[model samples]
Target: MVAGAPYPHELLPQLVEIFSEMSVCIGYNTSLDLGFLDRIGVPTEHLTVIDVMQRFVDYLNANGGTHRRASLSTCTKYFDYKWEGTAHNSLADAKATLYCYNMMKVIK
Candidate 1:
């Protein structure tokens, strides 16, 4: 499903609720992926939002490395990952974001 914007309130909560009912929702690379869910009134306690940025930072620090930028898109570009498509749909955008996030580790 595609959200109208990054901050599409209606879809976010619906997605969160669906995930909560199904299983723990997991996201990669994007720190703010679930922020919309919270901003649109999804309970933080009801869902889990993992910041892949923080996780990557921890991994980098553990291996004596550092990230130059904070944003996933920037980090992806800095690491030479390519996203060749527009982020029009939620799932596609999520996959692209994960690809970039995974590329960081792959580059390392």
Candidate 2:
């Protein structure tokens, strides 16, 4: 393990394999999620990625102002997401992202 590495390189190939099998990967913030995956040795280039945060940035900036970063909680609440778990928890955030995505789909 390199200094401060979160996980060892073991399972990296499996992670890449999983991503290779994905048709689309949706993330609330691709810059963070995908970048973290890349930093952790996951090959992200092959996966078609969607950044929901960017998609909703216009709405987030609806007041004719520049886009400011919005937290997952804020986005979820805006979509009326009924959060089932604690905020800042990974699984909960993922669910919230999915809910927000579905809401966006409905709006479109």
Predicted structure with the largest lDDT when compared to the true one: 2
TM-score of each: 0.53, 0.82
Encode model 1's per-residue lDDT on 39-91: one tens digit a residue: 66665565555555666666666777775435556545556655656554556
Superposed on all Cα atoms, the candidates' RMSDs to the truth, in angstroms, are 4.8, 3.7
- The residue ranges of model 2 lying beyond 4 angstroms of the native Cα positions read 1-8, 62-65
Task: List model 2 lDDT by residue over 1-108, tens digit each.
Answer: 258655647768888888878878898888887887899888788777778887788666675758767778778878888887987777888888888888878876
Q: Pick out the ten consecutive residues of candidate 2 with the lowest summed lDDT.
A: 1-10
Name the regions of candidate 1 deviating beyond 4 angstroms: 1-13, 28-35, 65-69, 87-92, 101-108
Candidate achieving the largest TM-score: 2
